[model samples]
Target chain A: MKTSRFALAVCLLFPALAFAHIGQGDIGGGLVAGFKHPILGLDHVIAMVAVGLWGAQLGRPAIWVLPVTFPLVMAFGGILGGLGLPLPGVEIAIALSAVALGLMVAFAARPPLWLAGILVAFFAIFHGHAHGAELPDTANAISYAVGFVVATGLLHALGILIGVAQRWRGGAYALRGGGAVIALGGLFFLASHFSILPGLDA
Target chain B: MNHFNAGFVHPLTAFEHVLAFAAVGLLIGQHGLQKAQFLILIFPLAVALGAAGARALPGLPLVAATNLVSLILFGALTALAKPLPHAALLAFCCAFGLTHGYANGSATTAQTSMLAFAAGLFAATFLVVAYGAAAAQYLLQRKISWIDIAVRVAGSWIAAIGLMALAIGMRGGLGR
Candidate 1:
């Protein structure tokens, strides 16, 4: 998966669009709101990327297992977080996950596959905590989680494109220097986290 | 159908909501699914917190501040078209989202305002994002700053509308 140095560079400059919303109380609505949150908000955007980057870097069974496990663990976490179970630093954890995952991708560092999965699953807990904490009274907590998992799997597929995104249609980043620019890309989110970048007026 | 849907519909269905949700859609088109899923899962929780914040404080100008800030930040996001290099977006979303959620909650009656409205608005918001992504797909190769230009232009309109709504709210006292 080799990407052009310039194109991927531009994406890094702009962290990309992410949509996420959380509502508590309505069983159906919560599920819907919960489902929408990750897709809409920017926070979840980087975290999802790290999942794919790390998965790609690790390769193989991880490619299959990591994505599946992450959402499952995340759903569990969402229940607890929405229920308002005490979990310190859920926000911070979410922030840190982005950093950790991005670093993994930037360096193309490959830990053992199982270790990588554990890392993602652990991060998924924080993501879930944040999700669960905001559960709407109307949302069916379990169903809301299922929606997220489905959505998360789809996100992984996009990240996988790095392997094929560069050349054409899915083949873009499969070349040798494809991910050479990934490190710089990681800088955008990391810098954003620390407030080093200029403010976004949008 | 009822008062609940009416109020809930406004926040989720309003043009700005549509545009902001489009920001997410663009993310799916430009970024990837895990990223989109992450946004879907986390933001609402943040909004719930924001809603709770509004409930707790409900102070002067908070609603206006949140709306104005979101408009500006989202407009900037559209304009800049980059992953914010820092927590700018996060700060932006959290402060505004809480207030938005609280506003959503406040908009409805306890009985009618149940989850249905939330679902309606959420569904509508996502549809807009998805549409935005689809709409922008052909132009994905172009710099989003151009998209930002259109967004800001629309944002100016939203600000105008917000002010008018504010005036109307002032006269009527509270959102309808």
Candidate 2:
């Protein structure tokens, strides 16, 4: 009985040790960790949702294309990160995506579909690189990839839902307001990362 | 015998492979078995050839890509239910089966008799496809629109999974 208990205790500690290096635990497995990464980070959540909102605003083809383009490009970014390639200022750029995408939503800026795709894909590299850089060494790569990609897509879908609210009266205003809020959050994230915001650097 | 068993069990092991055939089966159910007769008959033969080809040429490019695309295309087709030409549908099934068979074939070792492995694979595919089609056909025939909707939603999820796999393959980002 004592041996079994000791085995259980050691098993429990393994997961903790696995996650301790990244400074984020509470979640286990590479796939689950990857899934939660986007949702856990405020910057990733806002930017992903903002992409969906922007896609919804742009309407069909953009709706699907934008979401699809992100992971594809993000994967390329992941490859770069995995290969130990340096991409300067990934954190700053990720924060900037939220700001830029949020502002696009707030102002109801409608860029051409190609342009929107390009913009979203460009930011996705930083996001992907961040994810790739932190991948758990012991985690299942396929599952982790699946988890994060799906999580990102779901966030985009959530934003699309919010953007679709425009079908109702004053829905457009509500969306714009939501965009402003996301943009505000992005600014704070950017500030916090740069230690520009008081008490956030800690 | 172990080789035969391995071949039989191979398709069942992977979620993606099971999902691929299940999607095909679901389509057959939705459209009626009669309409999909050619698909039902030709898919296994094509898979056999693919598995053989894989054994012969281990360096088949785009096997993963093709498999992923099959998932996406089939899932989308299930969701849309857009009427397609018979030939188009047949071609889609054959192409999907071929890729999956190739993957399965390549996975088997040289010690495994290719014939036994192929037989096992064909048998497994047949059972899965037939059972899925029958189940969907029976349950969905109840005239419940929501059931149809649920199937469509499942289709979307499958497509999403495929898209995720595609991204991973593109970047080889999943940690080794």
Candidate 3:
């Protein structure tokens, strides 16, 4: 009787334990994958950070405006991509975004508010398209989208946090230096996309 | 899960629901505590009514779609960080609460007692909204410009999530 009771308990517990798996192609899995998508890509990471750094460098409304503009516009691009609407040269545009945005940071370029918003919006489309197009078929779409967008936003926050250092003397130089490195990294990615960088092309 | 526990956990389980609830609280809280206190009551009442009415409603999908729209609307309103006409805001709160509550209600099993489940749901939803309102009130009291900006940024994040989710849903990839 004791053995039978124990066996019954084990049977009851097994299914519950089995159902506890995390990231196993459920909403949680989709979220994890989507969150990882932007962070895992070096190109995406730098470009997103550049947006924050540039925003900080510009100060005021631009600081907040650029971050707001990116995600909303990115969602539009994502919609286009989800619908299988082809935007020509997505890869090239993504690579170019990094370079251009990074260079803007490196130079601490502060264009007019509308111009800056337009520039950021332009690059956001490519990034959003890349993410939307790459969404896994098995994943929950909403969760996955939430994951990537949140991840992207956090990356911007990270850049903004780092950019805050600019308030101190000599911090500006460091920020500009960071931007140059990002620009260089973007160049490497651009080159690899063209197969011009040996072994770096993934 | 028991009916009460199931109903309690429903809003917390879904990302969109959580966002929408928090956005409503934040938006209301932005105005002032008195407004939040009075306005917040409308949500649970509407929720209870919607949940009760869910048995008669035929289209679960429509409720869900509206819920997503509510997510976007609330997030955008919060991000705008501007005051709106009181009546309009009230209407938004009631409509959203109804839709979201209906969605929550449809998830219930027939074996459960409706009263117990609704009580649990009300408790959970109220806590989330109250917490959000309190947090926003705290930030407003600080009078820090950056805090306001951060709130706006958070609002944008919510809106972005809604937009992406809507797009993906439209693409026929939501539940898949």
Scored by TM-score, the top model is 3
How does the DockQ of candidate 1 come out?
0.02
| Clash-forming residue pairs, model 3 | none
CAPRI classification of candidate 2: incorrect
| Clashing residue pairs for model 2 | none
Question: iRMSD per model?
Answer: 18.7, 8.9, 4.6
Q: In model 3 chain B, which range of ten residues has the least summed lDDT? A: B1-10
Number of the top candidate by DockQ?
Answer: 3
TM-score of chain A of each: 0.67, 0.83, 0.86
What are the per-residue Cα lDDT tens digits for candidate 1 across B12-115? Answer: 43333443455544544444343444454444555545444444565545463355346435543443345543355445545555556665555444455445
Cα lDDT tens digits, model 1, A1-202, are: 3568776555333321211222222235434664586776555666686676566556565665565456546755754565457898676567667667766765567788778878888988888677556655454433354355446655665676554343353442332233434434445555665667879311
Q: Candidate 2 chain A: minimum summed lDDT over ten consecutive residues — where?
A: A18-27
> What TM-score does each of the candidates earn?
0.40, 0.66, 0.91
lDDT per residue (tens digit) for residues B1-176 in model 3: 35666567666667767788898888877878876577777887777667777766745676767877898899888888888888988899998898888877776656667777777778778888888888998997899878988888788888888888778777873434
Ranking by lDDT: 3, 2, 1
Total clashes in model 1, counting residue pairs 3 or more apart in sequence or in different chains: 84
Question: Candidate 3: which docking quality band?
Answer: acceptable
Query: In lDDT terms, how accurate is model 1?
Result: 0.51
Listed for each candidate, the true contacts retained, as a fraction, are 0.00, 0.07, 0.54
Candidate 1 residue spans exceeding 4 A from truth: A1-28, A165-202, B1-176
